[model samples]
Target: MKQDHRVVRRTAAALAAGALAAGALAGCSSKNQVPSIGYGVDAVIASYNGGSTLGANSGAAAVFSRVLTGFFYTGPDGQPVADTDSGTAKEVPGDAQTIQYRLSPEGVYSDGVQTSCDDLVLVWAAHSGRFTKAGPGGPVPLFDAASTDGYRDIERVDCQPGSKDATVVFRPGKHYSAWKTLFNAAELMPAHVIAAQVKIPNVVTPVQTGDQPTLERIADFWNNGWKLAPGKVDLTLLPSSGPYRIDSFGDKDGLVLVKNEKWWGDQPRTPRIVVWDGHSDLKSKVSDKSVGVLDVGAGSLGDVNLGGFRRQNLPGRGVEQLVLGTGGVFGSADARRAFALCVPRQALFDKFGHPDYNVKLGLGAGPLNSRTVQQDSVYYQAISGAGDKYKGGDATASQAAASSGMQNQTVRVGYLEPDEQHTAMVAAIGDACRAAGITVIDAGAPDFTASQLTDGKVDAILGGTAGMPGPSGSLNATDAIASLRTGAGLNFGRFGNGRYDAIADQLAAEDNSGTVLNLLTEQENLLWSEMPSIPLFAAPRTIGFGDGMENGVAGPTKEGAGWNMDRWVLKR
Candidate 1:
């Protein structure tokens, strides 16, 4: 039942020296006169929310994170810092879960309307999923959000209209490790613009103004009205509070941003920034010295011929995953484990140019990156030893199959066809599993989305999860585990088990940081034991900055290559 596949290794040697240096380091600085910075983005941003900007693509995330200021900012090393420059948040006295926020009086949208508590309330509602059950669809969220961790626990919001102050109280006994990271600047979209377009009846009201019907109407416009296209670009409609605003969107799939005159913070170093899409030829871009900056995320270093360009190792915030569909060929734990045991995880990572790209073999010791978990932590030690169950390669896989009668079993695995590296990795997986009597069928698709696998279109999927770092510089397992829970929005594998859910619930209730880490390790152990999904490798963030681009840094900051973008300047 072994299927034929080609396993080719890209030149991973290009990133060996650069990855060793580690940490966030700036590229070569310059004082040359350059008109603007032309950087490469990962996605063609069309919508301002929902399935567009906040989705899996990091390009839209980069733009939103920079232009919109949040209550908190994540440093290059993934630590959360309260952003007093734009706003201030303080815990209310006598209330363990209540916090008060005050915005800068100078903060205003591009249209001159002051950004106030109303905006924060709107963002909190959208991300909290509080109004989801109010709709007719029965527990369906009005607006799709990237993460709903801290917001979902919100009990009440007291906002002073026309003022910049608001108080938010969450339900008691709830624990959120990423409380500060939830409402970061990148997530605070323009509320006034959305309200105006939606045309809600009563304009000025308190934080809880929108009812079920009114909120649905507003959500409809908020999700679709902000979408931009060539010849359909409405410059006036896209009002923003960030340091920059959308100037123009070209028909050729290019986006341009210019300085925001209403910006409340310090002026950015570069006045203009342009982003292009689908430009995979980094070698040509570097050789021509045309592209000033490039986000080489999970790209092959062997193909990159760096001459004068600087390779900056971005933070490893992505994990390659192999998800098994319980309803399909991997209906039983034994079947799933047999195939996982045969997978050449190292080989698959090698093809992605691991080590060179600063890619780690797995989450290392826990659900988060190795850097976040202490070496002596119980969770770290558990994950370190958890790999023993399936470490024998072909022999281990063959034995697992023999025990479960899964030998020569056929399993269909799907991945995005456009992702050359993923395709190569899938091929490597197929080659490795063949000797164990498992056949991995290639089910490639164009631009694979979460809906595809979740809807049962594919039996198994080659997927990934982005790292969400906490205040202590470690990765939080809450969002990752929450998303994969049965019926969760991002749960594409349809993995459901009461035992797993109970463990996850227990993990969520633990208040102490140490307890959370131990629980995270337990969750990971349960996941590995069940074999619903196997962690492949952490995708390394890599970017090549051309000459004249000063203050360009690459690290494992959750913000991607744009972490220090405000300070980035094209030497003029």
Candidate 2:
């Protein structure tokens, strides 16, 4: 069913000479003050202080995450670096799993330090694994375990030292496969730059008194390092294998992201990206100007009807999920199926600003919906014998639940209610469930904590998988599955079908499908069959930029380092 939603987001446009008029040209010689040329979309609201900042705000995290090395790099024309996601990019079987990587002989950070397998080892450890001050307990997962030479995960380190192809390998526990399926989007960091500092991609004030932890120390010498904070935007560019390098950045003024002059591969279509700081309004300036700065803003034009602009029709990357938990507080399969049928997907769409905001409330991330468990999944397909009775609310068929040994209980639902966005959606889904005869007992707040799960009030929870570059596995199908049955996971709903879990386990250990996807169509098919968590919608990435600011500023509806901010230009 197609729905036209009115666009409610405010918007504006920058009219400049036809795109062909602006091309790449270098200018130098900064006087006392840096003469600047700017663009239209640079105004992003700044709230919260650093690490404790809004965790739900991916808009900020996406930009902050880019301050250092991007997880994976695409080519000048948006192509993934050749073989970047090769064998080394396999899944692990256990949460204690780790994957090693070998750098290409040619890999180098912007600072000229050659990238290596060690960097991957230490960096991944820093983000989620142990090795830093924080031990590897909790939900933090690392890519490489003990990143010593000839390590478990790393195959080779490429040129400089540990650089080499097929040198790195993943060393996840037996269940590592399940974990890998859930967390493939995390970018590996370079530890060389972060060695002496207490943290990799160190945030917060550098330790002035205590001796900073060295690479060796982090590797073996007590793993003494600083705690990482998401608060600070360390513009300090160490280096990276990705296309663009960080030229310079200020505390709050924003970072100037220029193309890597030393970039070894084909030059990027939009070479330089100058990210502006903070969300501000310079309306008149944008309309009357032609300068060297490609703008970064969040405010729309005062005169332009933002309503029309939003309706202009665009794509997005907002991910939504329906999770089922073993809260045991909920009903059995029969009851769950009844609840699923009652979910008002249509109303949920209507409330979130359809077409514009709600866009396509289609379930899950994969083609069939939820990426982790798909329709064709061996697990799902095997479970398929359960039949359509699970999806549609046919009384006669539901009666079969009694005959088939499916339970009859109403599952309680816990959902994320961190802010306005979460509240509305949760309410809508609740209404849907209410119509279906299932009572959606409000656990209160959309930002549901893990403790909520153990409390067992949550039969189902609403959440989303981290956005993957493309439609692939369940963010980490095996891990997502493991999370359901064994290890703790974002899958607050402890949903596990025996057949599906087994297939996911096998698929995780071996990428027989020839893709890095966690949630493939098979998984989606599985979700459709199981309806553990009803698939809700595909998340959209909103990117908006000045129309004529740069020659090739072509990007998504919401502008940022993620898209065409690099090739943008200023009119003279």
Candidate 3:
């Protein structure tokens, strides 16, 4: 999971509040001392939904990615590994397109509900887009999934309750490259919860158009009702389907998780885990030895000492890009391209990039970085030339803006408000664009809310999308392009191009590594001309820890520092 500046600010605020609360607790009573149980990790506890910004950005995904067992878990080497501990998914004998899955007999939710096929049905409904469209000609999805990759290919799902057995039939000739990674590691939540809340007659069958009344009710709840907070948590509704259960929560006190007694696997090394949303000051926290681990991020206490604690840089799997909202001032490709020229990428880096990392365009290409993309590829070579022509503050952009009839355009630039990094970056962009006779208006929002993206108010935004890197160096190139398509979940900019969509679809269908890379680079070249987005610098993964913490692993991907929390230990 990756995010923009708003997420970073939200995390800081939450952690700061938690720290204040911890201080208050200490002053109030003798029993207020930190618990001597499981090793603690600093995190921002936000919304619980796996598909939303709060889940993806605030490190809350770990509750689902690590605590709840998925069908397969992504290993340390960036490859999907089968999670035989939870279940087995195999191809059906006579049906090459269908896959069958059977759960481990010991698999059970924290509430003692046996893991069943019904849960898989819910996941299928959410990801398959079956319950996303409400009526004829409706453009917006009722339930917006995070990634509609493999699930969109599922044609049918047949599940038997109590048996924990199910079959998923894919669309004819639809070969999903990420099939193994789809459901293996995410919590599908419990089917019975939705069934009871929405008044559904049966929980095992695929939800269809006829069930819109009940399905819409379920979608509404799934979208917002499941949010978690200190005193506002609905424990009965958000039961865990994995190894740990939420024990308590608070706005300032932070969230706490305990080992599930019904967990069938090896007991977690730590008995209880306390997650502080914010510690007032990292330096003080380390000085007092109050925090066990600190999950530092970009622009958060840059290059601060850990008071003898260890520091390790993790593999970051995302990039920061400028997404042009094609519906407003940037409706013209020339306009978008001219504006891209004024994005002072280097200046923004000068303001924010520090001791841990530096800012570079990740090779003047698409959102795919050099880690998974070949710098010498034809596509990279092509886009690099185009990118160099702009290079913020260059006179070429000034002439281009004038020639393109955008010299005096007032482009509203939205970003995360109250974010120091975004404030500085936007200021630099304003200065650069003003030099080109274009005005950059601040239409920034508080956070990465969906409403802010699609309101058709802002002309452009400084944000990013999470990338999927493969063990074979094949980037899920289509994911970034797909976000610019019509009816795409993350297409907040209202940008769409039929020709680009056709090429992206082809790229999505390709499986060969070399072929995928070729198509990816080609598609990036095409998008460069359209300029729906300008690839910026790659986000760095740097985290700080407290003394005596060991084996604290930041997963090979951008899932975040908490992904491998179960393996972290404290040496006394």
lDDT per model vs. reference = 0.59, 0.36, 0.57
lDDT of 1 by residue, 1-572 (tens): 21100000011122333442211234434244466777663443555552222332323455555666777655444446566656787766554477888888888888898888887777777666666655465677777665565677777667765578988788876655456765665667677776777665322352376576777776676556777565578877777777788788774535777788888777777888776543334445456665677664555323566555566643354455676777667778888788878887655554553544342333332223222233334566554456545442557788888787678787777764445566677778778888888887778664454455556777677644521111012255333565556555545676787777666666655667677666666666677777777766555555666655556655343355555565566663
lDDT winner, 1 or 2: 1
How do all the candidates rank in terms of lDDT, highest first? Answer: 1, 3, 2
**Which lDDT tens digits does candidate 3 get at residues 232-341?**
98777766765567777864445667777877765655656666543234444545565566544355443355655555543234445667777667778998888877
Top lDDT prediction, candidate number: 1
TM-score of each: 0.82, 0.53, 0.80
lDDT of 2 by residue, 1-572 (tens): 21110010001112222322233233312212222334334323231111111221212323322223332322211222223311234322434444444445565766776655555444333323222344457433222221111122332222232444322234434433332221112234455555545354321111111223443344341221211222343444235444566555543344445566655544444544444433323333334442133322111222332321111222222234456654353335544555555565434434342334422222221223344444333444333332333333334433443443333345555543322344555666555444344445566442344336555756655544321111112222322343344322234454657666555545545655543343344554565555566644443222333322333332321123243233333333
* Best first by TM-score, ranked: 1, 3, 2
Candidate 2 segments exceeding 4 Å error: 1-107, 110-112, 123-166, 169-186, 197-319, 328-338, 346-370, 373-422, 435-463, 466-501, 508-532, 540-543, 549-565, 569-572
Residue 437's lDDT in candidate 3: 91
Clashing pairs in 1: 32-571, 32-572, 33-572, 67-242, 69-185, 70-184, 70-185, 315-555, 315-556
